[model samples]
Target: MTTLTYKADHHWRFSPILWGALVVAAVAVYLIFQDGVHLMVRWWQRDEYSHGYLIPLIALYLIWQRSDVLSRIRFDGSWVGPAIITLGLVVGLVGELATIYTVVQYAFLIVLYGAALSLVGPTAFRIIAIPMLILFFMIPLPGFLYNNLSSQLQLISSEIGVAVIRLFGISVYLEGNVIDLGGYRLQVVEACSGLRYLFPLMTLGFIVAYFYRAPLWKRLVIFVSTAPITVLMNSFRIGVIGVTVEYFGEEAAEGFLHDFEGWVVFMACFGVLFVEMWLLLRITGDKRPLSEVFAIDSPQKAQENEDTSARHLPTPFLSSVALLIVAVFGAASLAERQEIIPEREEFVTLPKELGGWRGRVEIMEQIYLDTLKLTDYRIINYTTDTEFVNFYSAYYDSQRKGASIHSPKTCLPGDGWRFNEIETHAVDGVTMGGKPLIVNRVLMTKGDRRQLVYYWFQGRSRIITNEYAAKWFIFWDALFNNRTDGALVRLVTPIREGADAAVADERLQEFTKELSKVLPEYIPG
Candidate 1:
């Protein structure tokens, strides 16, 4: 016993006590940065934070097991300590510059803990580094990735929500990703999607795994099941609400089911957690040397020695690590702020005149001269006008026209919609932002309800485009030039002065026939 005690007293390893303090400090930082967690939380959160708090306590509790090695730990100052500290400081500064606040701050703690491990000698270095590298999971993903996740969540939740409704024996019809529940429609809004629970639940699961000193297989089971469990339970909750509404009444669903139900569902999740814990314990056979779990820590010394005490590392090693740290911090900082280059406009030439119709297509004085022999002429320049002062070309109009087809013309509230029809009386062209557009007055309708449609078409430069035009750019050429130069005919059809899709289609067909006389090749029969 005395010989073993002597060896324990002389051995050096990364002290659990140091690990505990570092964990406490990290928890403190997170609590302090609560206002900014939205930016900081990328990879891991709930897992890391709770672990931070628990590890210290566990280390203290487990101190007895480590007593053999305790006396061997001695204060040894090394150049690596200052180097790590310096590297951490640099990481924080660069993170601040790029706004990757979480990673930069976390880097300091990682280096501090890692360097302290170094003091335990190379063996301790490898042992500690092996587990500590899991810190990478804590970093937040880039914004683009988050968006994709969000979209996926939206789709999955929306679809599953409808299925849940049907499973409740409620007559539900799903069309084009929309769920129709009797007269009311529930569009799984982004907030209602399961993604909100994903990050949080995964975090909770990881922390729970670390809390139980379960074997690797046990931890894997808990971790992998996190998201599926959360999403499935949430779907059940939504399904219950739909059942209540269909059978009991809307008041049952909206008044009680919709509003104050989150708490109840959350409680349900916790219940499932208890069951999960019980199962895990049974499956893994709780060999709970509690202190080893890092949750119930053994009492630790108030302060511990640094790992890098008196060690010399190659400059190249330091350089490579620094570069990697800088890269991670940089990525975290630029997550949401990538610069997008604006699209350049395309241009084309057109004839000065058409046969029989003088000045049908204008040739401006600021002209790049070109001539063609045809009975009719049209200008296909991208600009709305040839006038250098105002600069007009039908090409810009044509481009914007097709592109706007992709977006909903109706504003979120529908107040922006207007309708108009062709009339002999000329109305003044309206300029929006800095660009001018032709304003036509037409009648409008919504869902079989009739109303007038007063709409405006901007020629695509210096103009505030409508919700539709701003969204799509595919139509610029079709409206500006004769896409299918028809058998040389010219005619016009004034559509109904309204916002009805039915009316718009009829008008479009008639209007196409008018222009088809000039260019009939592109239009489908």
Candidate 2:
């Protein structure tokens, strides 16, 4: 028996050409990590939370996959490595200066590719690059995509929640984002609209894909599951909140549970994911693990085959210095976006789908959008330098159905106090279970005068559920806080600002366009 002893006689051959890749990779990580904060900040400006827990996880996963290759490759004292490092660093600096996340993203990718090419060679680089790039999905979507998704989820949530509640023998109705139960009414606020879960779902999807090494079929199944999971769980959540009022009284579901219960729904979603994995495994008994099927484990064999096949090129890497210049300019551009936004109006050009809702709005007001999905609306004028928030108090009293009976608060900016105003008007709106979208607007007053308005421009699909509370929780804050202080635009209006009152609508329109995303309805149709 030839005793295959461990190699004491073999020398680790380090390629100076390739060893340079590590420096390039390091510089890449630094640039990405730093810009990551700014990019995330932009997301936050658009009301999206940025989480960083997944980056290290993805990095580790990649490194682990390449451990076999790394074990044999050597680090020779090579100027080539330093040169690559310097090039990557220069690119990173350029990207940073440009403030362009895309440039940053591109720079990061180039560094990754360059490093992988130098260190691991062609076959290994090809095998690793795609999975590594897929990791980009872990980052939160930009504001535009998030807003679009929120609308879709809002429409879907409203329809589903209304259906579920009605089936449970509850007399429920919906309009736009609002839901009406026997003694309970809710407007599916931002938290209930599914934004919170959407990002996590995206992250979860990526993780599931990575860990399962799933085939397209398996991955698709996993991806598809997020929809029903979000919808049904949200429905159940809504039902729970509705029933909680019946059993524990309305106030019981009002505070923390109303806001934090979304985490519970999210956890419940995980159970569904796990079960799906189990089912997939059970279904594929005796078949290949997805990783094996996708040749995830075949890097060594792949490298050997490709080398023998001679189907790859070994061209020397060109200087990425030129690309680095482009990245720098791009970074500078991103920095420009960091500047403060200008003031604007609140009334968005409601799309035709939501246009009919302009007339259909019966009562528009801001609510916590928590346990109770609906509330009366109100409009508060802050410009009055009165002793007792007079403009808002009277505004609240007048629009009894439209205004929420709450103190001054804010959701936007300036020294604002948020207030709710409900306005009722009849108009066409998409409806399920006999609930129609209503029209209305509420203003958050700042320093007792200027206002950031909250208008439910279209109320065609108010669906309510507790599971989606996370998405709408932030919305509740905006309502209760009255588009609260921090960063925002403000316009002072008279105490009786309303549609028929001939209020100057331009400023408010500017606010919404500049501050908030597109109206939750208005799906481009």
Candidate 3:
């Protein structure tokens, strides 16, 4: 009997033409995605997304880890690559027209995927797909979505934290997101919403799951468990703070101790994730040590006698590169197109007295002015013989970059106000541009006080009540009319003790009627 042994031999080689094409493609991609990339980098400066800086490096490392398998795969590009690149370019154009960088960021990722697929083709692309997907973790959520999520997490964490505080036999009253500990009220502000931990931990979990050699279901569980783990750990930290503050002092919840506690809790969350992975392994009857099971395997080196050869550049890859070059030119043209900021009267010129109401203009705090980033704003308290209404209007000369009109639905909750009721309501006798003036009517409560609010987004010859509708119109007008300027007009009044809600509603309607008449000069709709 004769036994024959066969050894596999392969080598990685790229022709000079392919290298030149790659350089051109890279420059084109950077030019086309520079705006979105810059936006993402800016967002990374924030606490919740600081992890963005490390994601790309990790993706590169992950791809490097697969170099052994990649070395053997032939670089035959696919037609699908150009199709995907075209699709990404189309999406990017829409994003640019709308001045929404978040959409553009997603399109950048799609184009990157297409470029990779074009370079390596389907057979090898599959090997590095997860690493490619890991790049997505670098992008931040859109402002509107981030605000909504932060508000929801704040409420959830507050409720759980309050429950934890009760476990220590402390008397605590929960109102919206506030934790009233009789003397010291702990407001569960956006900072304590656990997002700072959640985002980073989720990214870590995803990376861990990718490396974990386990059943698919088990890997998913490991990845998904990060969210709950973060929430629970953060809530527990808040509870400990509450208990410490009750026994020690308010200082327990501030300064060094507060920051240190956060660090500890985050570390504990990581520990918990590891323990979960161990438990999962044990449950599956795997007795190997945890370190041995979960590890980064080094890429195997190519044999010394491996054959090295160079092939011509694929047509599909050339097509993808050509598409990117055209996209870069298109993007440059769009960048030159300036938004139309219509001339409007300053908020200072708004009437101090309207009809029967006497108005007192109030200055916003420096902190709020910094946060809002509005071109102009006015806050007036208008009072009549028996009622008072608070009038607020925030104008943005342009909402193209990152600055935008904050929706009350997100802002109110962060201020410890809970929405009791919200709906669209049309004023009986008020008209805007020959149409009935419609507004978002909101009844919000904070502790024992309740307030009725009426607000609408006025811009580009449109009065919009829905926040989403406002965004859509901003996109539409930005594309067609070269305008993304808008203002949020809000009228609010308290429902006094022993007063009917209808009374407050009537006060807002009356104030809105007067306010709408003069709104055009300021909002320029």
Candidate 4:
């Protein structure tokens, strides 16, 4: 009896003091990461990130399922916990300074990891580590990455969807991301990019892989197969919509039918995952029933004779909590620091006529306005005797939040344009900051239509051609200059049918020279 009692006492159990400390730590974490958490929740409202709402609950469930194993381990806190917590705090500070909430969101996860390690030490932490890592699925990708991914997925889905349509003995033409089916045209927009299914199915696959009783390689296959499964299933759904629309008119692709098709495809993806698992099991010579192969054992109950002594709070955990409290104060201080928005002329004041070119201003639709979230913008078509150029500029007073300039490289591809060549070119006659103007020069095509384009990012007296460099400057300026103001200046000209592309290039360069002189007034150095 004495030996049994001693063995039971060796096992760690949460006491009232520990529970109270956990509650305090939770509150501190909330206070420190409230802004990022709120933004994450807001992102959950979008279809692609809607699965975020379930990730936390699933993570908790995973931990709860392992409680039996957790209860057997002793809580010997390690100094590594405090070190990790310090690292997390430093990362959070950088995020706060840069005003990038995505960085702060990741830092929150890092701090939680440290806090968990501080409380339970390395032994028990290993048991719960995967579940903790799973929490990362809840955060949304950065806007630029998401746009680029969505564009690629859109193009893939469109091509596959058109192929599926052709397999049905129906004629279809594919140009970039658009599917032209004689009577009707279908543009594979961002919503149809398969990401909505990809994210949720990937999360589900990860959880399934954790529970699956199989060889390591087989479990990995189950998880990784989710991507191709989602893409193929989503493409099939699109193809089915096209076939239906061909017979039943445009109504087949709108309202309830379109949404119902999405649901069906997502369900089909799940079915495919299960089928793949079964195949893998067969290949491995496992003849056990599918139900038995995927085990989710109930947590074991504690013995009545176990020790019930109250455990003291660990010093590492207390230190972690103290660090979080300090972070709360730091975050509050950051919130008090207001960003500076410099005075600049609105795009409406931009000159219409310049350098012997006549211009016509164009109004963007409400959908684009909402998506761009620009403070001001100007879109105009400038024409000469035998040449024409399209000019567009977007400005943001503050890019601290998610609303930043969208790169033309990403946006153009989504609009059914394929990039043929991309390079940096310096306009000889045009200058910025007493240097030759350098811009991202691109030759893109959609079917037979070819266009020559030039664009660059202007911010904080810096002219940047690289998208990543622009982002770095935004972070740098936000931290030191207390400003995130920026603008995207783009010029485009169509290469007339059977004409040399060089003429269009010359037209854009000439127009760029004149436009550069006037842009400083609106975009500001």
Best by TM-score: 4
Write one digit per residue (lDDT tens) for candidate 3, span 1-525.
011111147566788999999999999999998988998899899788898999999998999998877777777788899999998988988988888888999999999999988878888788889998988888888766776877788888989988999998999988768888888887777678888888888899999999888889999999999999988987887787788888888875664335755457678888998999999988889888888878999889888889877756988999999999988888898888777889999999999899999999999988667657789999999998988899999999988777788888877776778889999898878887666899888898887899999988988889999889888898889888888899998888999877888888877778777877887888887
Pitting candidate 1 against candidate 4, the one with the higher lDDT is 4
User: In candidate 1, which residue ranges exceed 4 Å CA deviation?
Assistant: 1-139, 175-178, 256-267, 280-525
Candidate 4 structure quality by residue, lDDT tens digits, 1-525 = 223222443445789889998999999989888888999999999888898998999899999998876776667666788788888878887887888888989998988899999988777788899988889999988877887888789889998988888888988988778888887888887888899899988998998899998888888999999999998887887788788877777875664345755567778899998899889888878999899989889898887777655666888898888888887887788778778889988999899999899999999988778767889999999998987889999999988677888899878886778789999988878887555789999999988899999999987899999999999999998888888899999999999889888888888878887888888888767
What TM-score, computed on C-alpha atoms, does each candidate reach?
0.45, 0.51, 0.94, 0.95
RMSD of 4: 2.5
Minimal lDDT window, size 10, model 1:
399-408
Q: What's the distance in Å from true for residue 133, model 3?
A: 0.1
Model 1 lDDT per residue over 1-525, tens place: 235222332434444555554455344434433323444432233322233334334433334434434434443333454466456556654443333344454654555553444344343343344345444444554332343454455556556776888876679865423456887665554445565566556655665665566678877777788877767776676676677778888777777545634446555665676577677665667765434453544434433443323223333333434444554454455444432222322222322222222223345332211111122223321111311111122222221111111111222112222333332212233223323323333444333344322333322232223433432222232223222111111122223344444454343333323222432122111
| Cα lDDT for residue 218, candidate 2 | 87
Span of ten consecutive residues with least summed lDDT in model 2: 391-400
Clashes of 1: 71
Consecutive 10-residue window with the lowest summed lDDT within model 3: 1-10
Instruction: Score residue 10 of candidate 3 by CA lDDT.
Output: 59
How high is the lDDT of residue 327 in model 2?
47
Q: Rank the candidates by TM-score, best first.
A: 4, 3, 2, 1
Q: Please give, for residues 1-525, the per-residue lDDT of candidate 2 as tens digits.
A: 011211222223435543454355355355444565455445443222443455546656766676555433332122243355456555654544433343345455556556445444444445466556654654454322444555556656767767766666767666555676667776566667766665576567656765666667787788777767767777667666665655676787575346745567778887788777767876888365534533444223223322221111123332343333444455555544432212322233322121111211122333443311222222233221221111111111111111221212212211224354434322233332244433234554433343333333222123222212312432343333222111111223444333332243443333333222443322111
Error of 2 at 411 (Å): 16
lDDT of 3 at 299: 89
Sort by lDDT, best first: what order? 3, 4, 2, 1
In terms of lDDT, model 3 sits at 0.85
